[model samples]
Target: MNRSVYLASTLLICGATFAQAAPITAISELSMSHSFIINGGSEPAGIEIDTEPNSLTQSADATSQVDRPGFTPTDTSDVQVGNSFSDPPTPFEAQRTNSQTNLGNGDVATASYDVSILVENDPDIGNAEEDPIRRAVERSGIAAVSNAADPINAEAASSFTNTRDYRFTNTTDDAISFNIVGQFEAEMRAEHNGPEGFARTSGSFEMLFETGPGVDITYFPVAPYLITVDEDDPGASVAEMFFADDGAIAGVTFSGGASAIADGTQVEASLTAQTRYVFSITLEGGASMLLETAFTQVNAVQVAVPTATPVPLPASLPLLLAGLGGVAVLRRRRG
Candidate 1:
């Protein structure tokens, strides 16, 4: 699934002596996409379902025109969008919640904070998933025709946290082989191109899948799982985790620039007859950008596998089971 959201346009102005004609600009953007696929069974042809893809976007732009005439007027603006949905027996559930704040003062400066969270889950069984993307940017500079006398400085920070909790059960009377496969990609970039201006960006991300009882993994900054990009440095990182026995194995990678780091892995879980298993995914990341007349952003996507839980029983299942029991009793008496 592919999704993109863009928002925010504003101009900041202040009282200052027109010593030079300079147009200073500050901008920050952040977005994320996620996808999940469910398929696979022990014997019978595997079944698969696709979750409907949903997207949300928010944005703001700030510019300072101290000496240039005929420039766009300094106007403050903000935009927001959010939605959430839940339907039982539906293959998809998603929610987008966001909040933003922008500030400006006497100086030719701007600051903004944005937060957005995406969640999906199966409620009846307490299997929940939540993904949140957060970013903060602050830019300060004087409008000067020459960088020798005035300079522009801007800094942006971003973080991501995602949790996937699943409960798998074997309804059959005999043990069965259940498997899951995951495809993951994580990418990040921060760049700057201007005379006498420099740019630097860095970030760290990790993903992990664990098995146990009551394994509730909620919270940010979970142990680094995917990749970490250091300040002013650009590169990629690879990491993996495995469950014991026929359990599944998965991996994810991170890289700088627009190119995405991709990986694929499969996990086979040995589900005991008439037993339940709890598994979870804990993913986290943090990024920073510093530049002049430059931009920074991060993108992370994951294609999750299936959760093998029995389908809902039909309304007549009870009567049918009772009838079968009576027939068995009659057979025993005849024998």
Candidate 2:
């Protein structure tokens, strides 16, 4: 009694915002990723469970003189799973923080910065039957500025969110099915130097493939697919956007901008499916006010699960030589 046993769950969200001015330099970055792999000879054998619970936060702040007197400002924050211990496994190396501020020469001086992360999950079981498991996550944001003389202001912001749930059943009895190949990416960068310097970046993504239960699940489309961009924007007050969504094969949206000098944008997508899947991404960015200097960076999300190749057969085999010439002409008319 096997009815193709396979279940999965995941939910991710993101947010961002940054502004700059005064000998300004601005940078904004973002990231969100997901990966999956199933083995047992494609499916049907048995055990295949996964688990990943996470929640992370990162922060950085800088402020310049509020009127007089030094007033050096810089703030930092790091949180793991709402506190109380017992939840931390996603840092895998890549927790960053930066803040800088100076107020002395000019008149209006200021500097601001931000970075954020959020991950949520529950329901995990391990045992991929025998190898074949990969999971990933990335959250980023960066802001930079140079050329200050009072009349200074700067800001940076970043965000992240992660969630996971996967289960594949079939303790024998046969009957199982699962296959998924994936890819998602987005990146942006900007630089400015006068004419009110400015920079911008944005993001939105979603993926869903389901069946049965809770509000009746049903989604299609997950077949031969490919969308490209890989990098664009040479300058000239640049601007860019990426899109995807035609019912089911769902999710994809990105934005870019430039003013006074630099620009950057990157995008990519490739997918294939045979069942359970869920995805999400959200991002934002901005830069403003700059007498001469600005920089901004943004990364929407990058997810990959490469490993699914087996689609060849068309070298003019002509239906296997016409079924071997009809079994040798029926064995030469039975000799």
Candidate 3:
């Protein structure tokens, strides 16, 4: 064959081999969901009282009365909800054998005071304490309290009592909120040196919350758990998923914007083995959203790797080579 024809044939063969060698594979595709719970509580309520000496009689044939102070244990548990109590248990009557104890030798009168405060519709379980979300709530609550108090009298001795109630509800269609309460017990000791010499005083206290539903009672800093992901159909694309505490999705990350996963978008997620992911997806501008959970599927594609494809050579190379060969054959025949 002529030089042109030989070059053309070589080009055609290279194009076919390059096309077969091209790689077309799918890369990584992953889906994930965030699990959340809602928690809240009402304000505490109580009362305070102040008393002063009323009278004093001197060394004459006269009588006088003195003022005394007393306080009753406020029934904080009455307004508290979701706390469990033992049945057929010993009543306070058994606990308190007598009322009124007197100390010191002096003619004294007593003043008794009682007050009550109400707290309603608060969250008591998940997200109720030092968690990130609860921290924000606590900070806000503290700010409100600070603003309400008199700055000059902030440290004055004042009696405070308040009854609070809390509730936790699972609103997610596919997932349920697990409500838990944690109790912390600790002791603090301090040593001081006075005219009497070194002395140490240690105090211990316990805090309890009346969970309206039940008491979970766990330690602080609970470990994280696995959130599930939903499965996408073959060749189908999933856009975004919404997450909420106790299922309130509004104004949350899933509401919209950067945090949302849009159509044709890619997501990379690393999940612990043997863990589950529960997710809910609400389409853009759609009225309803779908909730799904990930499970162990043998054929499920956990990871993906993308492949690259090569460029194809010109298609006219083979035709050009055949035409050049025909010209060479004609010239040979004429000769």
On TM-score, the leading prediction is 1
Local distance difference test values of all predictions, in order = 0.23, 0.28, 0.18
Models ranked on TM-score: 1, 2, 3
lDDT of 1 at 94: 25
Residues 100-140, model 1: lDDT tens digits: 21222222322222323222333322212221111112211
Highest-lDDT candidate = 2
Can you give the TM-score per candidate against the true fold? 0.33, 0.32, 0.16
Clashes of 2: 18
Q: Residue-wise lDDT of candidate 3 within 1-335, one digit each (tens)?
A: 12212322332343333333321111111111122222322221111101112211111011111123431212111111221132311111100000111122111111111111111222322212211111111000000000011111110001111111222222333332222222211111111111111111111111112222221222233433222322232122212222222222211122110011112123221111111122221211111211111110000111111124423223222112122222222222211
Per-residue alpha-carbon lDDT of model 2 for 4-113, expressed as tens digits? Answer: 00000000000011223333332222232333333312432353332312311222333222333453555554543221122642323223333333344322222222
Weakest lDDT window of 10 consecutive positions for candidate 2: 1-10
Of 2 and 3, the candidate ranking higher by TM-score: 2
The 10 consecutive residues of candidate 1 with the worst lDDT sum are 267-276
Ranking by lDDT: 2, 1, 3
